[model samples]
Target: MARAHRREALLAAVLTGALTALALWRVQPGGSGYPVPETPEVCLRQFREAILQGDPERIRNLLSEEMHPHQDRLVREQQPRLTQTLSWVIVQTRQSGQSALVLVHEMHRDGWIYPVEYELLYREPAWQISRISYLPPEKASIAPGTHVREAPWGQELSAPPEPSRTEGPDPEDTP
Candidate 1:
């Protein structure tokens, strides 16, 4: 009876260990026990910081050079407009395998929200943004909406506003 009880206890311990291991595996992020901490949030935070600092070099470091030519073209063509009216506000991110898709909403000075999509790839153990594609907020079903509008500083600037009398606390007034 003593030997039988000991065997039963050992079997129970083994089964418990196996179950715990399986649970951990299933809940783990990267399919293995080790999870990469480079999540979409981290990526967006880094991207935002780079942009606000106006550090194109840092932004380039976060992107694959394979994408540089296309990005450069975009920068040259759109810089004049984008610099004025567009800022990135990341909305959501989804990850699968070594790729992530980031959904961003553009905040315009006029309070318009435009949806854009970015495709990011992880290669050589580092996450690099590969492509940026604009999408219709209504999903791919409808026609693409305008991605940007003309702002005062953009290429399509309208007549400048009349100079404000508020400027310089009235030149005629004494200090």
Candidate 2:
């Protein structure tokens, strides 16, 4: 009877340890101490990294089902080669209920910065990018109170437009 009690106690302890470990694993934040992205902005950052890294499958997974048809073409056009020096920063994000618009500045090796807008939809599990459009410089207006992330590598974030002046005679001509 003593031997039987000892065996049952050992089994119970082992089962308890296994259950505790499993519970901790499930509740752990990303298992690497960094919490998993639960916001649209963080997810968009992940998408940007995936683009820079040229991970086609990750990029496809981050996009919505509606964008699947254009995945091939998008990957061909937007995927930067591993050798290319490129970076991106979020210029603005607007969210209303299930839809969101994220504006980002994509900077290339050359001194060119492009404003790209991504439309995202909050599906059952997470936000998925639905559409992407490149805006002309004149069209990319930043709203007040919008958070603009700084560009990496000393790149200029943006330049405010100069105020328009009424057409008048030049100072030299007037003189």
In model 1, the Cα lDDT at residue 96 comes to 94
Model number with the top lDDT = 2
Q: In model 1, which runs have C-alpha deviations exceeding 4 angstroms?
A: 1-37, 76-88, 137-175
Error of 2 at 152 (Å): 19
Per-residue lDDT of candidate 1, residues 34-127 (tens digit): 3332665565556555565565665665667787667556455444434544556678888899999999876544555557687888775557
**Model 2 misplaced regions, further than 4 Å:** 1-37, 81-85, 137-175
For model 2, how does the per-residue alpha-carbon lDDT over 1-175 read when each residue is reduced to its tens digit? 9999999999999999999987665211213332234568977877767777777666766778899899888777776522232556788999999999999876555545677888998876567889989876432243323365732336665578897877998767885
CA-lDDT, candidates in order: 0.62, 0.70
lDDT assessment of candidate 1: 0.62
Task: Tell me how far the alpha carbon of residue 118 in candidate 1 is from the true structure, in angstroms, after superposition.
Answer: 0.6
Point to the candidate with the largest TM-score.
Answer: 2
